[model samples]
Target: MTKLKVAVIGCGSIAKHRHIPEYAAQDNVELVAFCDIVAERAQSFANQYGAKAYTSYEQLLQEADIDAVSVCTPNALHAPISIAALEAGKHVLCEKPMATSSEEADAMIAAVEKSGKKLMIAHNQRFVASHVKARQIIASGELGRIYSFRSAFGHGGPEGWSADGANSWFFKKELAFIGAMGDLGVHKTDLLRYLLGEEFVEVAAFVEQAAKENSTVDDSAVCILKSASGIIGTLAASWAYNGSEDNSTVFYAEKGILRLEDDPDYSLIIDYKNGNSERHSLGAIQSNEEGKQTTSHVIEQFIGSIVEDTTPPICGQEGKKSLQVILAALASHDTKQIVRV
Candidate 1:
């Protein structure tokens, strides 16, 4: 079997914990190179993996004989770097908040079309077992009409999880584009879209920099979103969620209430209108403090798409749509009015 030769761009904590580790575990893949603006960082990962390192991503793309690359760079770089890799005849699996804006995402999609290579956004929440099962239940019409929902993704912030720690790009407005909204909000919004099987059409929001005093980005945001099918909901993202993470969503439907990632013991819980209840302990999600690698099958799915010659589950178009929800919410915050997606 000819294993897929892969290179990782941006040897950050995300690469250290998720992308590189996952790629190394895959039987059909071999990590071939590592790249970072900081030569020492890239060289460290390369030495550990027994592959070459490059201080510049352009050099890696031009010289490495790799089949694909994982764009684990900052929010602003996702588009340009992924497009460069795609244009260089390499498949790309980019991190979330696919781009800072919809226009950049469109450019990425255009590049994908021109290159005829796969481009997948790493929205791993879709692959969580509980989320997968919840989608199945919702698709089965068991929950009936989803009237309202609350989706949240929050944590203490990226300080501990980022390679740069306190000075991580996640806290910078120029590099991150948006703070908590870009880091945590995109995940829930993307997951909500997948679970409900619909697009959000409008949003109203309040975004603020309430947590980190020195950062140039907002640390908290709350948005009210309405879906195409008339499902209204609240989406919250924050870096102020001290103590423990809250990555959960609850849906209120005609027949029942479905909650996911709410309870530590049960990942999913359904309470029927008939007074019956069901619970599922589908294992815990990947955690930073606990050092859990993943319940996130993002890498597996990305690799599978390349090997099988299938469209990525979270393609650029899908990622763009999810991103538009966040973009609309940002506009809503600035204008103090409902923005249409």
Candidate 2:
């Protein structure tokens, strides 16, 4: 078997903790190159992994002997880098909030279409054990129609996780575009779409900057979404939850309520309308917190899709649909009125 040579862009926290290590662990994948704006950071990883390093992704794409690349840079760089890799005839596994704007996301889709290469968005929440089980239960109609849901993903700001602490690009509006809304909010948006398997039509939200000092981007947002199926709910994403991370979602339905990641002992809990309850002990969700290092299976799926010549589970098109909702939420927040997706 010819191993797929893989390269990782950005030597930051995400690349350091997830992309690089995951790619190395794959039997059919070889770590060929590493790129980072900072020469030292890139060289450090390349030396550790016995791969070549480049400061510019353009140079890396042209010089490296690789079959695919992972765009683990800041939120703003996702689209451009993915498009570049696709055009260069290499597959891409891009980190989420896939792009800053719908226009950029569309261009990325166009690049994939033209290049005939695969592009998968790293929305790992969908691959979580409990999240996958929740989707199955909802699809089985076991929930008896999801009337509403509230999903929230919150944590202390990225200062503790990024390569540059408080001075991280996450707090800057130019590189991040939107703060919590882009970081944690987009994950819930994608997960909601995955669980409900429906598109949202309208949104109204309050995007605010409240917690971190000297931060230009919003630290929190509360959005009410109305789906095409007439289901409505609130989605909250925040950096203000400075205590401990909260990655939980609750679904209110005719049959009962399904609580996901709400309990440490039981990851999924179902409360039946007949005054009965069931609890499930599915595995944990990946977290940025120290020692929270469970495999999300995103890299495995991406590699499998390529090796098998199958469409990626979360393809560029699917990612675009989720990004559209986040764009709508931003409009609703700015106009102080409901916006259509």
Candidate 3:
């Protein structure tokens, strides 16, 4: 088995904690290069992973032997960097929300088409055990006609998570574009669609900066979604939650209700009208500092798809759908109307 040569474009926390480590863990994936505008950061990441460092992405992309690259940069640079990698004939796995807007995502899709390389978006939530079970239950008809859902992702703020804090790119509208909606909301949007196997056709959202001072983007958002199947739901993503970490989803169906979350325990609880209740714990509680699942599974899946010439479970095209929901929520927030997804 020829190992895939991989390069990481951003030496940020996500790339450090997730992408690079995940790729390094894979036996058939080699970390060939690391790139970041901050030279020391890139150098440190490269040294940690035993890879070469480059200050510019162009330098990394020029490596002829690199087979794939992970674009872990800010939301603004995802499209351009991923498109460039795809055009350079390397498979790309970009972090979500795929880009700031749908047009940017569309251009990435175009580049992937032209380059004839696999492109995947890293929506790690879909790979979590609880989420996968939800999909299986819904797909197996155990949920019995899914009608509605509630999903949320919330935390304190970016300042606590990153050394940059409020000054971090997450707080900047130009870098992150949107706040919690993009950082947290996009995960649930994609997960709900994946679990229910439906598309979010419209969204009515309320986004605000409730707690964060001097924040240009939203700190919290409550969104209502109408899926293509006419199933309606509410989603909340916030950076103002004064709790530990909150990532949860509830599904309502004609037969029963399903709960999926990881805080208290990795459990799926179900309730039926017959006064019967069932609680399930899918014990894969390996969460990162940000409470993200061990995303190494997702990275491996993407690499496998490229190796096998098969579509990834969450390919770039499918990844765009999740971002579409979040972006629509932003539009709905701005207009105070239902925005089409």
Candidate 4:
């Protein structure tokens, strides 16, 4: 069996904790290169993996012989780096939010089309066991028309999760684009879209920098969304949950209520209107802490897609749709009115 050569761009916390280790564990993958603007960071990862290191991503793309590259840079660089990697004839697994804006997302899709290579967004929430099961149950019509939902993703802040700590680029609007909405909220946005199997058609939002000091971007956000089929929901993203992380979602359907990631033991709990309940102990959701490494099915699915010559579960277009909701939310905040997604 031939091994797929993989390189990681931006040796940051996410790449170190998730991408590199996950790729290393894959029997069919050979970790080939590591790239970062900081030479020592890239060199450190390369030394650990016995791969080449480059301080310049352009040089790495030009020199490395790899089948795929994971773009784990700042949110602003996702589109440019992924597009370049795609044009260089390598498949790309870019971390979300896929781009800072929809126009950039479109450009990324164009590059994927031109290259004829796979482009998967690292929307890891979609691969969560509980979320996957919810999607399956919903698709089976067991939920009986999800009418509304309330989803949230919050933690102390990115300062604890970013490799640079308090000095992380995540607080800079130029790099992160939107603060909580881009960092944590987008995860919920993507997850809800995946779970509901519906696209949001309208959004109204209130975004603010309510918690983090010295931050130019929003630290908290609340968005009201309406799907095309008349499903309504609320999405809240925040960096002010100092007590504990709250990554939970409650789906209200005609028959019952479905709760995800809300319990300590069961990841999913379904309470039916018929006075019955179901509990599932599918594994816990991954934490946003810096050094914690958790099992993720993202790499396996990405590699499988390449090997089987199929589109990835979260392709560029699918990522774009999820991103559209976030972008629309931001627009709504800016204009103080509802925005069509």
Candidate 4, which segments miss by more than 4 Å at Cα? 290-293
User: For model 2, where is the 10-residue window of minimal lDDT?
Assistant: 16-25
Clashes of 3: 1
TM-score of each: 0.98, 0.99, 0.95, 0.98
lDDT of 1 by residue, 1-341 (tens): 99999999999988988899899889999898999999998999899989999988999999999999999999999999999999999999999999998889999999999999999999988999999999999999988888999988888999978989998998888899999998999889999999999999999999999889789998999999999989999999999999888888999999999999999899999999999999999998777765666646889999999989999999999999999999998999999999999
Q: What digit string (tens of lDDT, one per residue) describes model 2 on residues 1-341?
A: 89999999988998988988888889999998999999999999999989999999999999998999999988989998999999999999999889999899999999999999999999999999999999999999998988999999999889998999999999998889989988888889999999999999999999999898999899999999999989999999999897989999999999999999999899999999999999999878899988888887999999999999999999999999988888998899889999999
Would you list the C-alpha lDDT of every candidate in the order shown? 0.93, 0.93, 0.84, 0.92
Model 1 clashing-pair count: 0
lDDT of 3 by residue, 26-126 (tens): 99998878898989998987787788989889877886469999998888899999999999999999988898888998999999889999998888888
lDDT-better candidate, 2 vs 4: 2
After best superposition, candidate 4 residue 44: deviation in angstroms?
A: 0.8
Question: Would you list the clashing residue pairs of candidate 3?
Answer: 159-165
Per-prediction CA RMSD (Å):
0.9, 0.8, 1.7, 1.2
Using lDDT as the measure, name the better of candidate 2 and candidate 3: 2
